[model samples]
Target: MLGARGGWQALRGCASLPRAQPAVRLRVREALGAREPAGEVKVQGWVRSVRSQKEVLFLHINDGSSLENLQVVADPSLENRDLTFGSAVEVQGKLVKSPHKMQNMELKAETIRVVGPCDTWSFPLKMKERHPLEYVRQFPHLRCRNNMLGSLLRIRSEATAAIHSFFQDNGYVHIHTPIITSNDCEGAGELFQIEVSWVEKLPETHFFNVPAFLTVSGQLHLEVMAGAFTHVFTFGPTFRAENSQSRRHLAEFYMVEAELSFTESLQDVMQVMEDLFKTATNTVLSKCPRDVELFHKYIAPAQKDRLEQVLKNKFVTISYNEAVEILKQASQTFTFKPEWGCDLQTEHEKYLVKHCGEVPVFVINYPYDLKPFYMRDNEDGPQHTVAAVDLLVPGIGELCGGSLREERLPFLKSRLQRLGLADAYEWYLDLRKFGSVPHGGFGMGFERYLQYILGVDNIKDVIPFPRFPHSCIL
Candidate 1:
């Protein structure tokens, strides 16, 4: 439709258009360990330290991509007078080899511009001093600027990705379970109820027509999905109204739960949990070696060998009766005496793991009365045990808990009636009535896993924002 002269003009105009410029900025992690020298580059990060001499000024910058900060050597004439600690700045320079023993490459700055000015006297973090984690925890909003917390956050992110990859690669469908649920999975009765209000209210009215609470576990919901999908998992926030201020408990935390259908054997559930732990730990160790090293050297020195032992050895498996015998014959004094039907305490779990060479061990087939109503009955006469499994590690006891579900309708109804919870779970009984397969699932506390891996003493230090009994700051 166009003439030759017009077509030629349009082509010339298109040729004259400007192309998009390529990005020139490199992260501090890349800038510090660049294999080849880059002629000209741009870097942006927060200044960790500023050392000024008469001729040259040395600026250490970090962007949280790595544990190490990149050193920038700038001339005195580059207008770096305001480059104090914690100041955000953009640096334009050439990447070159550094003579310093700490790092490999340094940025030779031609121009330095301040993006945000920081007052050194008012900043909470000191330049060259290491602050205690407890002290830095007070400033929840700014603690990410510190090296330890920053490294921890990076490792957490990597671990999350590794977990997702593991599940996805193994044909597991990620199910986003409901956060607000009507049923309590644990049956511990420690639930936080949801309250709602309206400007124009009726005499007796509530949101859901009944009562609701934040979910304590996603295992029940994952089981619902597992009836349709072969393998399903959920990783999300779970809440509990626990009043204790123990370092091991959190009012709000994350849980990783998985359910598998057509699984009658308890070994299937234990095998999946073991593989997940080993795979995720291996991935974190390979990807975050430096961050793990930081935690090993500073946070927990003894945890390194323990974690290695867990990865190398096959997890030991034992029955609950065997564990009870061991505890009864042990020399260690316990607060609670070993009984046949009692639940294993943290001390007992730790002793069991230690008895098995300080590696992870699975204690299976617990007493039927100790578990919830959903667990399948093993029907062992006089002993009366359920097909339940709990994985205990050395540093942290009871890392994971799971059980084979009761697929028979009559048995489930009878068990629920005995527990006085039959009326509250009619829909659950329907799952058994209308074509239910043999299913099982497990729940792993995400914060506890982080604490186990990072060797952090308190669970609060591992999470970004901790919610416990009396504290919910920021």
Candidate 2:
């Protein structure tokens, strides 16, 4: 059963797709990049514009491959009622050099076919009109047709690839953590408990036989993997059950988490975090310059030079004590007054970034009581703190959060026992019972990272499907 007789033979029927001959199908990107004339080629895309003149007709089409649309020139006789904005079409054309100064190539079509026509009267988007982001947000299913969201999605895709490459290049094993877990990593209890819809008749029964909830963070799971593989990471969707009315919180979001083994100091963790951010930013800028330019040119003009300066220099670092002192001494009054032991609020974080010269800053050494139990405890006189750090950027308050995890069995056991999570996390304690080393890791909010790089105001705009308090549209 395990050999090729049953294993490979059973899947042989569905192993590979059917091989076929090639056709003259060309993507808009390829068509636009043609140097000389491409004869008898076919291009298919949705119509972005259809203009009719007395002598000729002009058509602009895009196939989601790039931001730039390919120009199609044809005789006025090819124009039809179905050839409107947002309609899908196929053109048998010859690609040639364009006379226009803006673009390089244009498509000279012999025949045009309307594969899918758009009902322009009922369509929400208009031809050549730049709709506001909020107006297009109402139509989530169709908003990708808009230029801004398309650019955003393209940049997001590149950033994701760059992050994965950064970890792989550094010899880190990528792990797929579970979506449903019993342990709440943050211990804040903001969890979405799972239940069977059909089991509503039996109110007392449990679905998984225990209280299972969507995982908040993969940090706890990555800690387990770190013991085996020295460096490990996971990037996936994480869920939270909050009536999130703010722009920052989403019911479902993504987190990029990494764990390291035998790391003695908190700086080791901070260095990796910094490197990941800079590498991803550089890759995205290099790969998708025009898509990135769309936002920098229109959305946030001042962000361009600030980002250049940020990439040129090192990020600033300060302790929680210093940050609190800085906030207290600032001329601007905070809504929540700055205190030594309390957690830093958004206003406090923004002020601290401003105080640090508008560059990204790492605020470390948080109060032990204010942090989770898993952080390594630093024993000091009357004022104990943990080795935790938060990377704050110019626009976004907190982009990344990390800490040196408690590797000692006795320290972790005592802390978990005090918090009444010892019984539930016995598997986690067992990792320390064996061969445990001083380990640390960090988690970066994917949307927050995108928001920081692009200077996006709302967190909802960066992500494709904005899942928040009263919205879950297709």
Candidate 3:
């Protein structure tokens, strides 16, 4: 250890040294957006294609920043055998106007260096061949190299940013909810329990003294925060062990949940949900026009007009009873016919959307027995109902679900007791005892939302790595 004087001198010596600066680099999107040619610029990316001629070698390089690849023109002498499709390389070149009509600029390479060599025979992706989405799903580890999936990822990133901005601008406090908890928000009895192995005899007590599981939703935690903050939101991963193999179900996915305090009725919650959907969609459409167009042109051509209609039309609202009545009168036959007390199936939801002129529609006032214990009782005389709502869109059935929470302590305790869950939710009951205001919230499945927006039929394609029943590929 150094003395005081020695330490001070050492500190002064350290402070006199120059700090290191990060190396300057430009993304492909940024480079392409330049107004004038850049001199002596350096670019590094994976080669998408390479063509060799007697005089010159042309390479198409992509950095996953945009759908379009950077055109690189190199002298034949600088070409190496490793500079093939999917090989990572760095080039020192000058940017110049391209003679080709496809792109505006090209890189005139002075020197080329191979950073990493990819085996063309083993690579799943091929040059100049369009691979179907299902075909690319087999290679989750390398699917981001494809132009379509890469564009989807970029759009997803932009949408996430837009959501955060929307919440922050609207005075909502962002909260991080716990990933492990003892209580299930949905009470669906489909939780993934956490278990730990023991070296010796099995321990009598669990890790948390009680059972724990991956959270199904962040609504309860957001509600806790809402008790303090007027408006709170959480965006994170949520898990469900439904063992569903449908196109819209996932074992693990992302959810965006928001809780609003001092809400008077269910309409307030519905309005916020509608606003969030529109705002985020508009932001994505404006910021990622090319990527959105790519999906529309190739994947789902019919979705473009539907999306425009969704943005333009006011979402239709109807009571659950009205929806059931309409379904009952429809000429279409159903496997599970629409009933008054049963939960709405995907077929019923799709029919409702189509009936509403192919626009988003909100069905409210669901039967009390159909919803969870936390929903507020509407007390509508003979047939009881809950102040709950579900937002249904054209392609996807139910996009969002929310309700006004039960603020009455006695009613909440009674409902919990009836469900045989009062002991597990003592703390939740205490929230009402201390001080509870009229509050409501909704949860939107991020993957499903992306699926509806991009018009991707399979939920697996929207997520980077999909987790489902009997499938958990990289």
Candidate 4:
């Protein structure tokens, strides 16, 4: 936002107006909500559009407070080169009832001052031009001025607040997990190891005295906290060095993770995931109706009805065997064939969601070997599986993944020993030594969740600064 004027420039615009009622400074959103007719007032915002007529000049200005712009009707004499689109300006005027049906109030400008001037010829965005997401994405520094991104960020903020409220209201203690850690929660080996600028390798001489890397998930640390606090949650940035540029993959992203102690069933974890999604979605819709409507109206036309169905109905659940069977019988051929032990591919996940009426589907009881060592073993038979679950939504395939953690000492010890991680995770083994309880947790990709709800095809657009393969734009 443009800074306020100092000394004399502060009172210049409003002071020039014939003072009957004292001028009140109101934001664009506040001015737009006038009932009858407010007296002298002042508003400041960036110029969105300027329409000059023979009698009057119509200017639409916005201050990023809302999606809608406040209409400012000024005399044609007030129009100048500096009042072009994308420039910052302040207007002193009388806020009166608008005769136009589109809005409730309009500003009858007494004076207009251009606070900050913009070079219109060099501006990436143009007046009355609805730039596509891909095009606007190129200008990362200035793309927020675009309507699509502005609406997305607003909705993202609301959803973030709603998530925090959901956990806090449900008796969960929030935790700040570490950004750099020695433990890999998922055991995927995809990590961004930290390094000093000039040093090559620092083992004993290292700052931390051991290898450290950016976190892949906060689940492990949350589990440590859950031992003390029955319920705990973490909402923060997590990183992975994945080299893919798929719409669903990002090198840097956020995860919403929660852990619950004294809960043995995957059903408990699944219930939390479903509840969190529905609660956050409802809040985002209520708080940012028009912003959400922008994506539904223009980006994805069918999303409105699709979202309603998801919110109103209960999520469907199927065992991993059942999911594999459904996929095997499907008439559609997949790039990766659906097998019992193989992890579900994005293609397979999309088909499963569509097969289940486009609602979120929870696939539980995956093969024991397919999941990480932390997941509790199902302890059944030749075709063995574990108590692991993944939530699949409509467009994006897997929105969340969770499992009931291995609580028994012998079971977890054996699993870690087989994977050669027993020595590395001695501290984790100590957690079981100190009276462990049956517990489970799940992690949902925050950006993926936003992508799912907003109908945004590209994951890059939902985040402010996307870090991906060979590209980290400011």
TM-score of each prediction? 0.93, 0.94, 0.94, 0.93
| Residue 72 in candidate 4, Cα distance off native in Å | 0.7
In candidate 4, position 83 carries an lDDT of 93
Residue lDDT tens for model 4, 1-474: 435756446556566656466689999989988787888899999999999999999999999889999999999999998999999999998999999999999999999999999999999999999999999989999999999999999998999999999999999999999999988998999999887886575455666778889999999999899789999999999999988989999999999999999998899999999999999999999999999999999999899899998999999999999999999999999999999999999999999999999999999999998999999999999988999999999999999999999999899999999999999988888889897999999999999999999899999999988899999876
Per-residue CA lDDT of candidate 3, range 1-474, in tens? 999999978877896777554334667776777668877788889999999999999999889888888889999999888988999998877888888887888889988899999999989999988899999999999999988899999999999999999999999999999999988999898899988877764667788889899999999988888899999999999999997889999999999999999997899999999999999999999999999998898999989888998898799999999999999999999889888899999999999999989898999999999899999999898789999999998778998999999999989999999999898899999899887999999999888899998899999899899899888876
- Candidate 3, superposed: residue stretches over 4 Å from native: 1-24, 201-203
Tell me how candidate 4 scores on lDDT.
Answer: 0.93
lDDT of 1 by residue, 375-411 (tens): 9999999999999999997777988999999999999
TM-score of 3: 0.94
Report the poorest 10 consecutive residues by lDDT, candidate 4.
1-10
When superposed on Cα atoms, how far off is each prediction in RMSD? Answer: 3.6, 7.3, 5.1, 5.3
- In candidate 1, what residue range of length 10 has the lowest lDDT sum? 15-24
Q: Which residue pairs in candidate 1 have backbone atoms (N, alpha carbon, C) closer than 3 angstroms, thus clashing?
A: none
Flag regions of model 4 displaced more than 4 Å: 1-22, 199-204
Off by over 4 Å in 1: 1-23, 79-81, 197-203
